[model samples]
Target: MTVHSALPDAGWAFTDDAGPAVTRLLDTLPVRPRLLGLGEPIHGEELFLRVRNRLLRHLVEHEGYRSIALESDCLAGLVVDEYVAGGPGSLDDVMARGISHGWGAFAGNRELVAWMREYNQGRPDGDRLRFYGFDAPTEMMYAQSPRHSLTEVRDHLTAWGDAGQLPDDAALIDDLAGADDRWTDEAAAMDPSRSVGSSPEAVRLRLLADDLRALLMAQAPRLLATAPEADRWRARLHARAASGLLRYHAVMAAASPSRYARLMVTRDTMMAENLLGIAAREADRGPTLVFAHNAHLQREEGHWRSDYLDQALIWWTAGAIAAAELGDRYAFVATAVGAIHHRGLGAPAADTLEGVLSTLPDDPYLLAGRRLATALRTADLAPVRRSDNTDDHGFFPRDPAHIADSDGILFLRDVPTDKP
Candidate 1:
């Protein structure tokens, strides 16, 4: 396995000239090339199509990758539902169906929508491309209270002694009276400040409810890992820390196996290690594409300096260590999306566009939709902003510096036509 560090000069330098460095590194690979494209703006639909068609051709025809998973939530179920309902359908059809059938919202760009529409349009229902949902809650809560395992919660809801009838408050009270010891322990651990109620039952239920939701969201890696081989499902656990429910604990336990009994250690790490173990067991299965955000995939030992250092140091570092221990059957791809102009979470100003365009090479295609270039040309970039908020909250300046260090890029399929 080769480790390609994009920029060797500076540890934390962000620049716009990352393409050349990435190209140079990729040219040295011997296997069927795994190329990650980080796109710059292009004017027309033709350019967008050219890029996407090339990408699809490479992934589907050349590479023999049967499954393509996105960083989306519950998308797999939708794909299955669509397949079951009819077969292949358009992007608009899928969205309409999702909304009408209470599927959920499509949160991102039109590129994905367009891609789905085009890819699945003409294919037969059974022969249509396969898609999988990445995340779903495996656990649930009743109001806000002590947590219960998904099975336990489901059972409790089912056995209210009223056949096919939903339980009322009194039934719920009786159910809680017979709750497990773990639920009680978890309830006692809640911080009083955040929870509103002072009563023991109320506090217990609230904390349990919160913890149950947490547990449900945390079940991604485990469920993915243990899914039956016949299910034609492939799972990718991509996180830097043991932050996720199953994989994190599994890796941690695996790292120190002797500290705990073999059975205990296995139990701890089983969910997280499920995918890796399954991959090892079924080496003949078709390739599964697991694209992690930058922090999870970057090599910890080399490329000590990173553009995402401020953004994801702690998690990235830990994930790298865990990945190393897991061995090297997996291909780790680090993605670099192009530079973004931060519009400070308000109305777009004219100057911001000019600053972004100024850094681009002189091309009519690149400047086709630019309305802010004239205003930004004269603006000063002196006031660099800082925020203590670690969360992906608030707006900030669109510094091209960050994109400059990216090893590769992933472009939006559709380039916006209308600009304010």
Candidate 2:
């Protein structure tokens, strides 16, 4: 490895002039991925987001990628989509309401949103870019009330020239939802006693949500046939949001031993569905750029330790499922960082993925995972994993075995943070 430690000439330097690099990477791919996921090691890093933004632009301009998805609330992303597509809304309001998990405040996300809006200016609908959030609307801190999604579905149906076909009571969903506090209780995440998932109201709501979902699906053909293409898409989104939120609420109210795991899996499952939906709608238009954490986008099984439960949790990620379903049409590039500020992470020790990549004399670069893994094997340096000592939610270990499963790896030597 030392022989090739001086950064192989095959990798592309991370810079503003990344169009050629992206083109090369796309051309070199054994299979064209309809969903090209760019995974980040950590969140809130401005550099990572900006780099992703640049790459997305390149894919859109050159490779004809039409959609950009992120690790954000699927329902909330509608506001963002509307804004980017020249809808009525101020940037501040869109940032506040369109983004979830408090990510809208990040300078990187703000810049991306602004640039997307600017890019859409004067572009025809066919040439315009679409923004989407692939995560469930609920958060780890507190799940949002399912009222918005449920009511949105009802309202859309009512306007569809068939209010009589649905439930007569406008207050039915609100009444069933009850107080938002019941679902958003923070302690319920770990303590079964605090959860109301099995409550009678919740059970009833589940049944009703199911009925509503079935009704929407049954009527979809007729509704879609009568409406314009855009209206049809909007109607489908409303249906998805309603059903997805109901399912999320049902999970939130669960009091089982596997509640947390179910929630985790459910969130990712929703993400996968949303992604596939986008692919179905826009695959003909272009590929999609999915920006998310490595854990959510990796093809390998995801691993994490829960401090609340004092045990490890492992599950399949959205990317893995997509890869399985899409076959070679889903490509993933996991980002590995060598150092981070505030978390005390610095120059990775040799033997680790970061450490091995750090040997290459580049601030940032893209390495073909298989080639890099081969080089590591040649140098007799086994790739090591990162430790889970810090409480950083963005941190995850990159097992070397994942190289065979991944299309490429985006390596950053250091992460820039707001440390003074």
Candidate 3:
């Protein structure tokens, strides 16, 4: 039942018998592979139910993973709020009639709600399952405007600190609160043209904001720095900075609606990464689930960008790094659900590389075939040289050697016809 083993270096391959070892790990009593996937669709309760059932069966019956960590915004606070409001009600009641019942909320997913209720029903009183929201509001706030005024940034930080959500570090709070004034004084001391832009006042304000952020990064625990119990604080600060900058940039880019749209997309990406980091920290205590976008979990190392530079990849890597640093156990599971059929032109359809390659020129196919031949012949296929278009929607192929060290992964796609 033990899944632990020495991880092979980057390119090692497993033998044909690798399947049994993976199956054995899945058969183990307590090794639960976390579920990381996209959000619920607009109107697909049936689809949601099916997915939830599969996840539940695997966790409760097969792996015995009791906790369900949802990727919700304000998840912990939301649950705590609901619990506080409805003292004796179950989570289902809370979802159906209490806090999560208003219009435009997730009230429609009755089956999923019921499952969550039952999951929490048997737990000891005051020991309910933990729900951690990975969304970072600071990034979202910044995305609202392109050019944040010094006053605006300071106000946002102060408000967050006042709220119990942010840490009550007196020294850190004081430094951030005074950051605006310091930026202004420094800007005032500099030459007008260099310190400010063509519009001296406007440019000065922007420079002041930048200077404040730089000062904070220099003095505070920046994202890369190692500090005790600093992850939460660093996450908050980064989220705030990202959200503020996003909002400021959006306002400036308002002239080009298309460009502004792109910025918003980038902001979402940044927010997702921040949320993943937060979720990872919350789950550090034990085996936990991470519900998020497919893009956030899939390994993108072979793609054009360096793994270290990509935000989502960075988030996953950071979790692994943090787990190791804390001496806490952890494992990653990548989930991908493909489309049944192509819908329309200009719309993304789930098509495999093999399927697409069939329509391409013979020369390219031959080249690809030769590359596959090389890979199969060589036991060790360097990860860097792996092709991105091998599987469904280029889903990152799981290297058993990489994952065998911790726990077996569960590929939720292509679900079996009969239920367990």
**In TM-score terms, which candidate is top?**
2
lDDT of each: 0.32, 0.77, 0.35
Winner on lDDT between 2 and 3 is 2
TM-score per candidate, chains pooled: 0.40, 0.92, 0.42
Better of 1 and 2 by TM-score: 2
Write candidate 1's Cα lDDT for 102-148 as tens digits. Answer: 33233332343455445666665433344433322111110112222
1-420 per-residue lDDT for model 2 (tens digits):
254653575467766778876776777687778999999876777788888988988888888898899999887898899999999989999999999989898878888899899999999998888999888777875666666666766766667636678855445888878888887888876665676666777677666666666667777776776656666566566566656666766666666667667777877877888888888888778999999988899998888777766767777899988888998899998888888756667677776667777877666788776666666665555645554446564577578766757678888887766622
- Cα TM-score of candidate 1: 0.40
lDDT measured at residue 400 in model 1 versus the true structure, 0 to 100: 28
lDDT rank order: 2, 3, 1
Candidate maximizing lDDT: 2
Task: Please give me the total number of clashing residue pairs in predicted model 1.
Answer: 21
Error of 1 at 206 (Å): 18
lDDT tens digits, residue span 1-420, model 3: 111111111111222233333334344424333432322211122343355445544554444444443433332234433353334656555554432213114432344445555566666634444444444332222322213333433444444332232233322433333333322333222223222222333444445555545544553533234333433344344444444443434333344424333443443454445444544544544344544333333332212232422333223332343234333233444322222222111212213322222222221111111222333342333342123233323233333234332232332222222322
